[model samples]
Target: MMNEQLLDSKFETEIFNSQIEMKSLFYNLETEIQSNISNLSDFAFESHTDLKQLIISTNVTLQDNLKALQTDIMQQLQQVTDQNLITQAIITDFKSDILNNLSAIATYMNNNQLSMKNNFSFTNSQITNLNTTMQTNFNQVIADVQNTNMNIKNNFTQTNQKIDTVNAQINAVVTNNQFQTQIDLLKQQIQNISVSVSISQSMTSDQYRCLMIAAWYGSYTARDNYFNSEQYLIYLTDSGCPLLKWW
Candidate 1:
């Protein structure tokens, strides 16, 4: 801005100086012409040829000086015009570059904002999904624990029933007098236990307890019936009624 103002001042000064030079040159020419015209009358007695040559030469010199001044003024104006064109072009390019930079910055900011919003939404969704999955897993664990407790309670009940059945058999053996009646009752109870074990093919802690109690009591009870005891043992082994289930 400062440089432009300085240039404009200089251009105006140059134009004003050129106008003054033109006015000065015209005043000098007019004064010289008036002096020659006054001298022409005095030299009227002299030859006409000298007077004609003087007038022609003065006119030619004036025209040449005017042409030279006009050319110099035009050259100065051309220089100022060229400087203005260069300044305008530079300003235009600067404005274009600044506008492009501003547009890029705005676009970058908008893209970053959108990306941040998307990232936040994705993070929130992940957190929600994680919470939902954790809740589901917690519920499954609770259900499994409940099922385990129910199974344990049922097994405990079955074991107690087996104990009661063993006590009843022991009482019957001690109270009854007939040897065949005691043998038959013992055989039936042993066969039932063997069948139950074979059908399961595996043993629970409660089932193992029942087997131990029955085996201990039956061993004592079957001492009087060696042949029948051997037969029951052979039947239990053949039926896969193993107390220890390695297979």
Candidate 2:
């Protein structure tokens, strides 16, 4: 804009200078016309009268032509002035419209910025809430897992205690029972009976049967220790087994 204004001022200055030059040319022409008339009058004879009239007439025509040229120049200058005004008006209106658009754009940006800020705030709030919820849930899950682990540990401890109790009971029953003592005593009695019987290599069948009966009833079992022994004794009296019926 500054450059353009400078160029416009320069153009106007040039036009002013041209107007001054034209005015100077017209003034010089007028002065030369006066000098020529003075020279003609100073030599005026009856024969020079027609030449004087022709010079005067030519000078008037030149003056009229100069006036017409000045009028055209002034009209062109007026047109240039009007064009400059129109251009200035157009530039002013363009500046105003541009300023208005810039203002509107700024306003629009502000409104959108406010809306975006609100949206971001809402999103941030939601994210914060989600994070809090996740933290709570995560903490709860951790507690549940700890509880589960504790329960598992408790159950395993109980199981181990129960196994220990069962092992203690089994050890007591195995170590403190009288069955092995009874079995050893029975074996010793059987050895004593065999040694007594080896006093004779030969024996009657009845005597052998008596010794077998003594081993069966006394060493292996006792009739007085049974609750329902009479039925078995009756069956044994008529037993079909070869060893029981040898007598």
Candidate 3:
């Protein structure tokens, strides 16, 4: 149950992060468009240009800006799309593995359901082995996700730095406020998510699962008190999923 919840949580996280990346990219594009609008409006107002010439120049500027913005947006969008594809593939694979694990666990449980149900014949050594294997796989998945996130973050950092350099070059000519605040806020949000993800990874283990069960079923009030428990996540089950459970 805990594993299923974790899987669902991870899947949701991937989707959310992908959307966040898309939002950041769109925000950048929006800022660029606003800047262009301001520039063209100012040109129309301040210059003693012929109306025909002004219209032509403004139209050309808009076209060029749109094309450039499209290119930039497409590149960012592709990166995010690719990342999402990879994340989805990973999730699919993990779901299969987890399902197999659950099926095996369920079968074992059902076979011993009547007599010594909880005491089902599995040895401590076998349980330990399964735990070790699960832990190793979990660690590897976390590492892969972390690496992917870091790579994206590094790309974002590099792109932002380049943008800042370009903005500096055109600061005097551009009327916009450089849109630095939005960029900073977006970056901070990503960082916060990264930290939370790392904390989540660190808290997950066999011992933690045991703790989750203890807290989940120990008290009447605590039975559904999944709010503070790490295992209280969205997961899949043999019966049906995505299920939310405290353990």
lDDT against the true structure, each candidate: 0.52, 0.51, 0.52
The TM-score, computed over Cα atoms with residue i paired to residue i, of candidate 1 is: 0.26
lDDT of 1 by residue, 1-247 (tens): 9999999999999999999999897676656544543343223213223333444564475556556655655665565566556555655655565566557557755777676576877645654665676566556556655655565566556556655655565555345444344444544544544543454433455545534533453454445432233555555455554432311
TM-score of 2: 0.33
Question: Per-residue CA lDDT of candidate 2, range 67-94, in tens?
Answer: 6655655665565566556555655655
User: Model 2, stretches more than 4 Å misplaced?
Assistant: 1-116, 175-177, 192-195, 200-247
TM-score of each: 0.26, 0.33, 0.37
Q: Provide the global lDDT of candidate 3 against the true structure.
A: 0.52
Worst 10 residues of 2 by lDDT: 40-49
The residue pairs in collision within model 2 are none
Report per-prediction Cα RMSD to one decimal: 75.5, 82.2, 40.8
